[model samples]
Target: MSDFIKRARAAEQAMRSVFPATPLQRNVLLSERYDADIWLKREDLSPVRSYKIRGAFNAMRKQDGQDLFVCASAGNHAQGVAFMCKHMGVKGVIFMPVTTPQQKIQKTRMFGGDHVEIHLTGDYFDDCLGAAQDWSAEKGGYFLSPFDDMDVIEGQASIAVEIEAELGVPDHVILPVGGGGMSAGVTTWFGDRTHCLFSEPAGGACLRAALAAGHPTTLDHVDTFVDGAAVGRIGQKPFDLLRDRHLSDVLVLSEDRICATILELLNVEGIVLEPAGALAVEAVGEVQSFIRGKTVVCVTSGGNFDFERLPEVKERAQRYSGVKKYFILRLPQRPGALKEFLGILGPDDDIARFEYMKKSARNFGSVLIGIETSKPENFVRLFAHLDDAGFTYTDITNDETLAQFVI
Candidate 1:
């Protein structure tokens, strides 16, 4: 047996004391959709609603006389470490970006209780990380990296141990990569036995960037929507292990496409997957041909979704599917101008948003309109009606800059 596999098994054994292995059952909806036997390693159903707890648990357990643990995170990793601190009776200090959602902050506090102290510093995760590391050094405490540490990687490998024990081996496994800890450990365990496809958010595909550059490269910017796996760079140790991986093994998914998957899973299968948790599941569509007749497993990484973002998620999903759109319309400044424009919409079309941007214009008014309909085909008819009516309008649905300021 390989040393990494042996250690992973040991870590899996140790993890049973903290939380049971997450579900690795077949998903009927995904199975039928892809024409393959699809299984989900439901890490989203873990104790802390993420696989992060495994790394935190194993890392804490392996340490000796480490009374204090410090980490910087604004999402699942924070809660994972906090839960471990409360469980192991160790003092923990968690640093979070000031802009982190209140829901996440509250959840972390609830999990850690009095065992952990939270300090909100800086506006971004990097800023918080720097503060946490500086505090750890100054106070003589162990600084726990979300994924960079060796112990954390070993802890994450426990997932592969559980998977092999339950299913022998899967033909293909889809993994979501952030800092590469989980990908490194899981890949190390399965090695060449299983075909592993690494999934990353297209905007923050540090792993893909690293593979292209032949080394770790910091992303210029990252879209934090998939907060669970949108890392700027992969860890050095993980890169070292995954350096030999083929470029084709990595898949970049559109952030909007992921939102559509999230809505699909929720509405179709009654599964509420957070953006990051949906990463692996979302990639299945792109690789459907490859796994059409094979046994596949997609790791649902985390389900720490904030309910308040439901509107944004829904909007994104609708926009991506083309069933919803936003447009700037020029309306003649007349009493019935709004009514005339409304006649252009199909019977199934519904206006989700309507705002008059320039009502002071004497000849015409600039109107921001958001339309939702039963099907994407409805947009074709609506646009045709607008054309026939001689209405001047601009579809700003895919205009990022304009949407950012208005949507």
Candidate 2:
């Protein structure tokens, strides 16, 4: 066995003292859908509701003389470090962006209890990260990187060790890429034996950028919807390990489409997967033809979803599936005009939203309308009827800038 694999096994053994191995269960629903033996590595079931705890545990345990641990994160990494600090009986100072959701902040405090101190700093994660590094350097505290550290990378490899022990090696392993610690470790441990696939949110596909540039390249913009995996740039250490891998191995999934997968898993399978957690499972659609009869494993990376976001998730899912749309309509300021517009909708269509303003001197009024239908094809029919009736409208469902202001 390679030395890396041996260390990973050791880390896995050490973790038994804390939390049990997460389940590796065959998903009959997914298996039937893909016509393949599909399994989910339930990392979402980990103590902190993420695989992040594994790296935090391993890294903290290896620091024999270290008493102070510091880290900056707006999500899972903060909770992971806080949990470990409480478990290891060490002092931890965690830095988080000031704009982080109250749910996440409360959870981190709950996990750390009195063992950890949380400092809300800056508006963005990078701002807090810089403050954390500066504090660590000044106070001589050991700074814990979310993914860039070698010890953390090795700690993350424990996931692969547990997987191999449960079912040996599968034909394919789908991993979600953020900072790349977990993917790097798992891929390294599995090595050439498994066809490893990396999944990234299309808005923050840092791994894809790195592969194209032949080095880690920071993205100009990032959509923070997939908070767990929306990294602006892949970690330098992770890129070093993943650089040799083919670009085709990386899959970029649309943010809106991922919401549909999240809703499907929630409604059909009763699985509450965060956007990042659902990436690997969503990727199955892209590779269904290739793994028809093979054994496949998808790592459900995290389940730290906030219930308040459910409405937005449903909205995005409906829009992506074409069952929902928003539009601005020009309605004549005359009697029966509103009634005439309503007549354009089909039997299966329902008005989800409607707002109108009639200018005193204008001949026409502007109407903002949102429509929901039973099927995606129903929209085509609805549009056809609108066109035939001579009603002027603009589809604003896919207009990012306009939707942000109106929707």
Candidate 3:
């Protein structure tokens, strides 16, 4: 066995002092769907509801005499560090963005109890990070990076050690890529023994961008829907470990599609997964051909989801599945105009929204319409009927800016 694997095994054994290894259970639903022996490494079931606690605990344990630790995070990492600080009886100062939800702040407080102090500083994570770094430096406190630190990477490798200890190395392992710490650690430990696949949210595919550019690169814009994994740049240390990985091994899934997967897991399997947690399981469909008949494992990274986002999740999923759409129609000013438009609808189609915009000419008015249907094919027929009737309409379901402002 290599030195890294040995260290990972040691880390895994040491982690039992804090919490037991997370479950690795065969998922019958996914196995049947993909024709593979599918298993889920349930990091979502951790005390912090994320694999982040592994890295946090490992990094903090090695600090020995360091009683003061500082870190910045708006989500899972904050909770992980807070939990560990409480467990280690160390003082921790955590900085988070001002816009962070109350539920998350409460959870971090609950985890840390009296051992951690949370400072809600700026509106963005970068701002909070800078403040945390400066504050930690001034106080002679050790700064705990969420992913870039070597100890944290090795800590994350404990996940791989746990899997290997139980299943003796599956044929393939699919991991969700955020700053790439967990994926890098797992890949380093597995090396040539297992085929590894990385899944990332399309809005923040830092790993894919880094692989393409031959180095870590910053993104101009990132959608924060997948808040846990939406990193602007891959961590320097993580990129170094993942530098040799091919672009083909990375799958960038759309945010909308990920929402669909989140809903599917919740509705079908009774699994409540955050957006990042669903990435690996969602990628299974993208590589079904290669993983077929093989033993495959997907790391479900976190379940720190708020039920308040359910409506938005459902809307995004419906839009991606083509079962829902919003459009603006040019309606004639005649008395029967609305009735004539309704006559073109299919039996399965339902009107979710109908409103007449005030911006209208004497002869014509702009009508905003939202439609929900049983199948994607329903839109084809519905649109065909609209065309036949000489109705002018603009589909705004995919119009990002316009939909954001109006829908």
Candidate 4:
């Protein structure tokens, strides 16, 4: 084993006291569907419902005499640090964006109890991070970065350690990349022994951007639907480890498509996963041909899903599948125009939403319509009918720019 892998193994041993190893189970549904032996490294099932706790625990344990630790996170990392603080009986200060979900904030508070202080600051993660860093420096406490530090990366390698011990060496491993700590740690441990595919949300492809530029670079914008993995910038330390990595090894997933994967796992495999947690699973369909008969392990990174978002997840999945669509229709002033337009819809189609935007003139009116159907092909049939009937309409379901304001 390489020196890094050896140290990672030692870190895994040390982490046993904090939390047991997350499960690595063969997913029968995925195995049969993909015609490959598929396994999931269930990091989502960890103590804090994420692999984050491993890094936090390892980093805190190595601190020489630092009584106070600080970090900023909107979700998983906050809970991880809070759990570690309570476990270590040390004081911790956690900063989160003011817009963070109430469920995550409550979970962090529950984990830390009296051992940690929670500060809701700023509107964005960067702002909270800045505040955390300034406070850490002012108080002379160690700032525990969520993914940027070497010790944190080393600690995350424990996932690879457990994977190896549980299942030997898999032919290929798929990991979700955010700021790169988990990917860096796992890939560094496997080295040349296993083929590795790194997946990231298309909206937050920081690793892909880094690989293209040959260094860490910031994304112009990030889609935070996959909150856990939506990092705007890749960490320098982790990017250094990933610099020479082949571009083909990095895969980017659409945030909407990831929702489909999350729904699939929940419905088909009875596994519940957050959007970031489903990244590796989403790549399986894209890389199916590459792993034909070989065993593949997908690291399901976290499962800290808020049930309040389930409706949104289903909506996204339906939109991506083309089973749900929004349209704007221009209705003639004639009284029977509404009836004629409704008649054009297919038998299976149902109006999910309809609202009229009145016009001052009596000659024409605009209506916003939402349609849902059992099959995506139903939309094509409905569109054909509408075209033949001469109904003026625009489909805005897949139009990101237009959907922003209307949908």
Residue-by-residue lDDT tens digits, candidate 1, 139-200: 99999999888888989998888888899899999999988999999998898999999999
lDDT of 3 by residue, 1-407 (tens): 37777777778889899898999999999999999999999999999999999889989989999999999886888999999998889999999888676667889999999999999997666668789999999999999988888888999999998899899999999999988899999999999899999999998899999999999998887777887887788889999988998889999999999999999999999999999999999999999988889999999999989888999999999999999999999999889988989999999999999988965788999989999999999999999999999999999999999998889
Tens digit of lDDT per residue, candidate 4, span 1-407? Answer: 47787778889999887779999999988898899999999999999999999889889889977789999886889999999889888999999988777778899999999999999998666678889999999998899999999789999999999999989999999999988999999999998899999999998899999999998998988777788887888999999898989999899989889999889889877898999999999999889988989999999999988889998999999998889999998888897998998788878899998988776367888889999999999988998989888888888888899889877
Displacement of the residue 344 alpha carbon in candidate 1, Å: 1.7
TM-score for all predictions?
0.97, 0.97, 0.97, 0.97
Off by over 4 Å in 2: 357-361
Q: What global local distance difference test value does model 2 have?
A: 0.91
| TM-score of decoy 3 | 0.97
Q: List, in order, the clash count of every candidate structure.
A: 0, 0, 0, 0
C-alpha local distance difference test of each model: 0.89, 0.91, 0.91, 0.90
lDDT (Cα, tens digit) per residue for candidate 2, span 163-241? 8888999999999999899999999999899999999999889999999999999898878888788788888998888
The predicted structure with the larger lDDT, 1 or 3, is 3
